[model samples]
Target chain A: MPQIAQLAATYSSQIFWMLLTFGFVFFVIGLGMVPKVQSTVDARDKKIADDLDAAKASSAAADALEADWRAKENAARSDAQARLAAAKADAAKDREARLAAADAAIGEKLAAAEAQIEAGRGKALGEIEAVAAEAATDIVRRLAGAEVSSDAALQAVKAVI
Target chain B: MHQFTIEPMFGTDHWAIGGYNIAFTNSAMWMVLAAVVIWAFVALGMKRQLVPGRWQMAVETMTGFIDNLLSANVGPEGKKFVPYVFSLFMFILCANLLGLLPLGVIGSHAFTFTSHFTATGVLAILSFSIVLIVGFARHGFHFFSLFVPHGTPGWLLWLIPVIELVSFLVRPFSLGLRLFVAMMAGHILLEVLSSFVINSANAGPGWGLMIGVPSFLLMIGISALELLVAVIQAYVFALLTSLYINDAVNLH
Candidate 1:
């Protein structure tokens, strides 16, 4: 249509500026902000990965230390048990030696006392026999006259024994 | 038919500023009215209510329609440029639709046609720049290689520049022409058909009714066609612009 032709004819002059504006904005976005966006995403990803690695390493170290601590505790417990058994054995030996020494002393004292009582009993028996003989001789002398005293003593001794 | 032609005004009384003709023009008045209408639509669209009203629907339809269309065509990449594309589409659409409006101010005062020429020129320049800038922004100097393409024979290199230059140069021409032509055609058709109604009305009553009804119907159809054409032209203009920029910025 002629109207279209007129429209086209009218707008011919504006083409240059329009083209320029498009070119300018194109350069601004392409060369400027795109790289920044990419780098930011990259940096964030790297930081997250680093943190995860650090956490894993620390936990591994902690686990290793815990294992070591358990081993040491096991060794200490065994050593303590051995020491306690040795101490108990030494205490039993010492008690037995002390009890044996005390029993020996008691036996020696009893034996000495028993031997002394036997010797005293023997001496006292001999004296008592002698005295009985004398008394009996005296009694016979008083009852029967002088010459018959010997025979009387013998008979009195036999009766007294 | 009325005399319809475009010639630059040049005379003692004709004012010229910076080598561009300065004259009161029909295109200028139409563009002003279009601007007012668009502004009103924008204001109405932004009434900021939870529920969208009719005026807001009108604005959203244009924006959402373009958004969906681009998303469908170019995927996410098209969505990034929706605002710019929508604004550009709206401007072009308004220019096209304004031509359908009756061309008298206060029912009598006729505007100068020089203003219309400048406004269309400005729009063409704007759309051309958007394509250029958008492509370059996306691809940088790499955009320039898009014109050269890939896998061409050494002998074809000469043809490449020629084709590229012609295509690039034609960008603004197509944009400006598409809107101007559609608007101009719709207005002319409506004028002719309505003139028949006016003339036939003076004839016998049946004659008037006979022509009037058909003319009215034709006008309505043409008006609808104009609406469709207006949106199509704007889309074509922007699309070609983007395609050209894509050519300019892409690498093989």
Candidate 2:
């Protein structure tokens, strides 16, 4: 009963101080501490996000560089292979030209050797015919003791020899 | 037993306004002390780190717990009331624990303001007033519909509103009473048990050990429980405030 009874007189003073304190706490804490703490948290989170983004970007750049290098290496290899194949084809062409020229020179030499042999054989056969005609005229005069013409003897020897 | 008395901390002939006992009494001084202590606690604990330390973790946990309670009860709009609820919870919590200190009760110095109905009642009234003002402001005349239950018989509707009105009016008393009674009862129990331990120990050495041990153990257990009660009462005060505000905003 005294508790209820005292409340009438006591409430005003209690309330005045209560209001002052409670209001002080509300304004100071709500406006002051809450926002400060929140900003710190947000700043920390932002830094983390920025670091993560940078890491991802650098990794992607590295991957792209590796890919470009591989492509360049492949291109250079193909270029070397093409040059090698062209050199091989040129060498084959040069060898075939040299062989054809050698074949033509051998054919010309064979024809010249056959022509000289034919001329020498013709001269030797003419001398042999003249000797045979002389011999034939002498043999006819000795065997029959009859006079035979040199021109007729030579003609007969040319026909037989 | 004498610890619950209200007396002026300083001389009687000091500051008084208009014959009112505005003299800085034990109650008012403790209220200020509690405020200062809480202020130091939260203000100093505001050191922000990505991974919180012990003090920051405690502060953040308390704030986050209150925030979750508000969101659950009052939805997002309750966020605006965080400072008020924070002040109320911390102030009451500090006051309750300060009263349990080793300070003598001759002047009732450091008496918990929450143990007095006047202080707790003011908080209840403030919360109730917000509920009324917000309910009416948001819903206009339709706020009266709060007492009207849905799917009632037309004849019984009149009786239901009367009951509802009484129930609604009882909220402030119940809110204040719950905090005051819990704190006062816990302190009274501790006082009684501690006195018992002292009295038994003085009876005789042999009998003192027989009875005093149990009494001392009980007192220790009760003190631990009281500590738990202190935290719980603060939580309940804020939770009820949020619930009332929730009803005002969301209806039902």
Candidate 3:
């Protein structure tokens, strides 16, 4: 056909150039750019996931530390309460012993005064009764919350000496 | 005066190139003249300036024109083809300008050129062939398939192939026809006009000379117009080829 002949006449050079151009593009894209693009995308996705995982783990650790601090605070509060209770009990026992010792000393002084009054047959017995009575009065005054003390009266006697 | 002659350069006893019934023609001279003009313009533009003269400015137009054209139409990736396009523009431009010269007529021994039908026809084909080859290589056999657009109904599938074949068939025809017609028309016009001018000059006296001057001026004007046409036709031929290739290699 004349058309065929004309086409051939027109396109001979084009046929040659096309074959070379196609081969070059195939070699460049199939072997080079495509594979590189795929691997780079995969690497990027993996990196993102890894960063997210690391972030999650760190946040979890922070939560755990917060929980631990709350638990330790509760333990310290209970321990302080236990120490305070023991101190209050010790103070109460010390106060009761001091009160009992004061009562025993006062009772012993009254009994000694009565024995001196019954056994003596002179003024010494009367003086002993006076001393017992004074000691009982001072003890009653001390028990009733007066500021006067037996040491102040003794200080005056010592000053005369 | 320069010697001009076309003493049968090729043929089987006088036709064709390298071998066949083709004769050497003046078009070849014009082609050379075009080359020199382009070279001289480029040389002129490159010299003397931080600021370019008009000659240099004209030469530099190619660099900017093709650069912008390719980048805008095909994206910056296609800018690589600028040199080929620029050269194509220059060659045709030179050929058209040379067609205007009266150096190669029969009356003038200093310059005369004539082309056999085969020579003129073949030269036009040669330029088209370059475009076709480059495009096909750029896209491959896929280039041939470019005629058929994707997404047609199954019932219409048969028509697609026929349409594609017909479209494929028109490429070489259109490309060759445009250049051949333009060149043929220019030569025929120049030949007919020159004949009239010669005969008219002998027909009268002072009036004959006076009429001849205007006729000569018309020829000169046509010659300049032909120069512009030559470059433009070459560009259209090349650009259409690029568009065809773009269709083949890229869908958009």
Pick the DockQ winner: 2
TM-score (second chain) of model 2: 0.91
For model 1, residues A1-161, the per-residue Cα lDDT tens digits are 33456654444332332323333322332223223322343455577889899999999999999999999999999999999999999999998988888888888888988888888877776566556767766766678755445556656676767
Instruction: Point out the worst 10-residue segment of candidate 3 chain A by lDDT.
Output: A10-19
TM-score of each: 0.49, 0.71, 0.47
Better of 1 and 3 by DockQ: 1
Please state the Cα-based DockQ of model 2 relative to the true two-chain complex: 0.28
DockQ of each: 0.03, 0.28, 0.01
Categorize the docking of model 2.
acceptable
Better of 2 and 3 by lDDT: 2
Q: Give me the displacement of residue B220 in model 1, in angstroms.
A: 3.8
Worst 10 residues of 1 chain A by lDDT: A29-38
Deviation (Å) of A17 in candidate 2:
2.5
TM-score of 1: 0.49
How do the candidates rank by TM-score, highest first? 2, 1, 3
Chain A of candidate 2 gets a TM-score of 0.51
What would the per-residue lDDT of candidate 3 be over residues B185-225, giving only the tens digit for each residue? Answer: 77667666776688788887675687777778888888887
lDDT of 2 by residue, B1-252 (tens): 456555666684256677665656677888888888888888777888887788877877777777778888889998877766777788788988987775664742357778888778888888899889999999999988889977778999869999988999999999999999999898888878777778888888876888888888998899899889999999899998889888899888
